[model samples]
Target: MAESSTARVIRLRPVDDVAIAAVDVAAGTGVDAGGGVVVARDDVPRGHKIALRALRAGAPVLRYGQVIGFAGRDIAEGEHVHLHNLEYREFRRDYEFGVDARITEVLAEADRDTFAGYVRSDGRVGTRNYLGVLTTVNCSATAAKQIAARLRHSGVLDEFENVDGVVALTHGTGCGMAPDGEGAAVLRRVMRGYLTHPNFAGFVVLGLGCEDNQIAALTRDVHMRPEVPVFTSTIQELGGTRKTVAAGVARLTEMLPIANAARRSRVPASALVLGTNCGGSDSYSGLTANPALGNAVDRLVRQGGTGIVGETPEIYGTEHMLVRRAVSERVGRKLLERIDWWREYTAKNGGSMDNNPSPGNKAGGLTTILEKSLGAVAKGGTTALTDVVEYAEPVTTPGFVFMDTPGYDPVSVTGIVAGGATVVCFTTGRGSAFGCAPVPSIKIATNTPLYQHMTDDMDINAGGIVDGDTTVEQVGERIYRRVLAVASGEPTRSESLDYGEEEFVPWHLGTVM
Candidate 1:
């Protein structure tokens, strides 16, 4: 609330174990003993946390008064506890499935409130109006793009002011892949999801038709049906590539007006599905941006919305925290199963989860997966873990759901969006240029320096946490407001930069045959 300056202190929660500095405390300065104890023994930055009391070696470190991790060594009062002295310890996690559970009350309220989104006859809502060009295989990518290019040249978009840019959803893999196997199956499902995604006002499904992934089979598997506008084609049927492009363009010309008729209206927050992720993370991510977003997650959940925290590897050492808050042990165990799968997945792939924390993260003061995870999990806030899902599984539970995905920034985020996240809140310290297709991404800078330097890229300055200018809740509220604004039509920094199209990379587990 107040502008950042010296002599300001803020608490994250009423019962928080520590207070964060509103301004950077000089080295060797005596921090006044507030109602709580001094925790920082070193020169602490504005957004960093201080201890509430003396901590013994191996004692669990608390933030939001929750066990984020354990102190690897002794931590003195007023001393900073971070990567150097904290270690991740594995223990048997206790799961309480379906016990002492609370159903989200907001779902009931959302049943009544509605947004003026494009209500597809299929019963899904479209936040933005757009025409989509879908390719069945790599063989058809050029043709798909050519069709889109022709539409652009024809003044087609100029005629449809309400529609967003026509997007050609093409990728590297499709044919030469096994037709009925794992990779093919996953890719097929993802493609189906996009074809049917509520965001598209209209879509054209194009295929070379001779590839292993035949257009007939894909349509059958996806149950391809739409209440609004849709056009389908095959290269063989349209007289090959050149003829197919002409046909596709002709089809799009007719669909433009129908796509342009959609507009945005006041929508209740419940219609919002917020995707939570962090990238280029630093020591302060958990302390500032993550928790700040967590508060926003809680606020959204309170308002009858959905929040998804993905990146299964990022949640490695801190999953127990989520388990304890799980509405059902089944949900908690589902998360654990994913964690176990990753362990085996990495080992078989000649890697380990500990091999995370990219060079950038280490330079920013992060050490191991355990240390990074402590901060990573903070983005979920204090809500009960409502559900755990497989990669790109449609998120049905409203509050907070965890989707299995690798921690790779682009790949992980793609899974979150595919799972139906309408808006994404991404936290970064080293600055990342990431975007989501159909869905918009909101980037929050973890520290003030990066925020100011990359003002064009970052949407929110959670670095205020380190500057001692605002509390986590204040920044959280700021992010929450931005989510609503972006959902309602404000373009995020990533959207302005056109950072999502080529970055539509889905995670590939096996070899690219």
Candidate 2:
């Protein structure tokens, strides 16, 4: 849906009870509401909702032709609709599994697009060739960081041109938890995924020796390509932090030439596993960036590639839409099961599913989690939900799939990347600074103002859609092409700023003790 530059407000659906202000609309301004012009009763900030008609207290408000919230009190026509008057409440939805699962037309092999990538010995493709330092416990984080830092800043990488960069993948909670509990299992799985990740030419597993997450146990039965070298050490065994760092740097130094020997070759687009996520969202997120990213996801699916959309909590209200698109009842049911799990998970933790749409989101015009979810699910596009996997689980299904993950941006993205996403497309209306190492993240801004404000961080301006300067398909095709180019070794804005190292967060489940 495109809008005219002169449009004062945008009505997403004919049945929508509200319209989004295209710009800051002052009180008494007459705005066209499709059916007729309505005088604004109050000032409506850009991206905020404006009621199209008066409604009594307890009346349901709709947007995108679905219920977003209920009115807290009587509202006048053209009144600003936001948190002060809108409130969230539980409502039932029909799952209707497989109701809209359409068969995708996969591009013919001869016509499929290709990108330059490194084909690993295990037959997986990698968009980057890098040596990584993996920490088994938080106690070893400093040593891990020092090791990666020494190699990265030593100018040693200058000799190995094929290497992308050495990175230390550290986390905050590998210890102070049960060894055989859910949290430990998740940590181990994430570490294993990175160990076998095609993005890394090789990696070292660093531990604190006395932590519950021991290197021996973590690597047990885990296999890496024989051609890929791996080393394991502990601060205790290495004597101290300085010695551990020295040993790590020396070992990785020897492996740099081996890593540099790997070269990129043309691979089919099917080799790409694109992860979709949105953060720092505003009302325009649904209108612009998210839908545009969804369009690109559709294009990738048509090429026989995989697309993973997670952040389970953020999709609460719109899950029924995804459920209907599931390719099978089993896949749809799995998604609902995860949703139920989150409901119980949040309830037991003294929280409600409605505890979302952060302060930044509200400040940017988002009101409720329901409203936020409607926009969030647009990142999946109109593709069949081929499968739903647990957090950090391997994503082998082609086409679009869902993963169970928290709404926190870093944790959600870490799960997606761990599940084998070779590239990520992150949409932001409030300008989220994020990156996932090894797998590059492409940032798309939801509004022209945010894009122009953070030009250095944003990769594409999907905001053009809201500006009436471009269509969703146009921006989507641009995003899809950018994905290919980035997969072929083009540095994304995030990578250029070296933003991925600090964002390596793993989902922490169960008690810290």
Candidate 3:
């Protein structure tokens, strides 16, 4: 049952009915399946699953010792197990709340890791020091972009060595929905989060007249650090687009000196709140990047830092696993409530949770939502699930937590950042290009080919684990160290390419009217 470094197939568990192809396998090729070698009955692409034994139709296919899906037809040994033969089926899950929850061994303060960070007057640590221009509605998006563009390209930031540069946080919706509905409430919460985000030394809120989301109302209850300067205005009040842009530039220009005065100081790693997400995932995701990231998250949690994992729909089939790790039955029920809400939400929209695992995911060897969710949940590590919060809700708990957000990358990460995550760690097998301004994002590749193909975009290659060149703990420790370096001012690949501005999408829910 011992696997060699060059094993052509990987069996994750002793009870698994299938093994993952370590490389593209041609028909007639023999692959090691732990118990015995199985000859391939069909060509299996790398990262795809291969049946270890004959499976009768309607029987469950197991991976990681859990059911991934049901066989639509009889599957012969070594046959490729994918869309053509696998089918999604609903099943019951027992929620044994707190059954697996365990206390984390927090490191002593003197033994904890440290990172150079900008400490705000509110006692929060910031990973980046940028001045942000936030838009109240899509109508003022252009003005916000122009203000940031002018400052970025004008050589104005060169004078302030400590400031990261000005960024425009714009979105597509703000005016078309009811002001008091869930949509507006969500938008207001997101804007307010960005307004006071510790990463921004100062910020300006711009709005266009006649929008349901008024600048005044959005900023009404927002309380910011007194040292952080904030300016709010509208296009009509400032005369026009030209005037608004010019006035915004002038105000930020005045605040630049004050923002630049901030300096990075050594802070305990406990001050870090890590946001974890995965996109463009493949079968190798669970084996390589995702679990490796989870290891790193465990390390962070042990150091007394917080780790947030989201993507609610993507975790549908694996919520029971998390429920067992919940710190309390109340917290576990809260997560179940969100899952129920998503079920109703998707059903109301005439969609199914199986709508996920896009074409890219399928090509990468995922067959059903159940199969995908099993891999997706690996990013949370084995820490106790302390709290579950609504989308864009501030994450106050110190251990591992879950946030309710869609599987869409941008909206999910945006919610995490809004909840006060200072840095983000993203894993991908299909090469998802992403970034979050102010909050630095570290991209980890699930396989070697994708990392080499998109070398400029990927920050770490977790593929070493798949290739037998490294262990999960080694790659995980590397990711954890890279996180500290990035938080201490290292620019990530996405940051160098300026990918954050356009990716700041908030989840738009409810009616447009």
Model 1 gets an lDDT of: 0.76
- RMSD, one per candidate, in order: 4.1, 1.2, 1.1
The Cα error of candidate 1 at residue 73, in Å, is 9.1
TM-score of each: 0.84, 0.98, 0.99
User: How many residue pairs clash in all the candidates, one count each?
Assistant: 14, 0, 0
Candidate 3 achieves a global lDDT of 0.92
State in Å the error of residue 419, model 1: 1.9
Clashes of 3: 0
**What lDDT does candidate 1 reach at residue 421?**
78
The residue-by-residue lDDT of candidate 3 on 1-513, one tens digit each, is 235344478888989999998888899888887788788899999999999999999999999889999999999998999999999999889999999998798999999999999999989999999999999899999999999999888898999999998889999999879899999999989888888889998888898988999988898898889998898889999999999989999999999999999999999999999999999999999899999999999999999999999999999999999999999999999999999998998899999887879999999999899889999899999999999999999999999999999999999999999999999999999999999987999999999999999999999999988787999999999999999999999999999998888889999987997
lDDT of 2 by residue, 1-513 (tens): 423334478888999999998899888888886778888889899999889899899998999999999999999998999999999988889889999998799999789999999999989999999999999999999999999988888998998889999999999988888999999999998888888889998888899999989898899968889999999989999999989999999999989889999999998999999999999999999999999999999999999999999999999998899989999999999999999999999999999899989999998889999999999999999989999999989999999999999999999999999999999999999999999998899999999999899999999998888777899999999999999999999999999999998899999998987
Instruction: Give per-residue lDDT, candidate 3, residue 72.
Output: 97
Which sections of candidate 1 miss by over 4 Å? 1-92, 96-103, 107-116, 223-225, 236-240
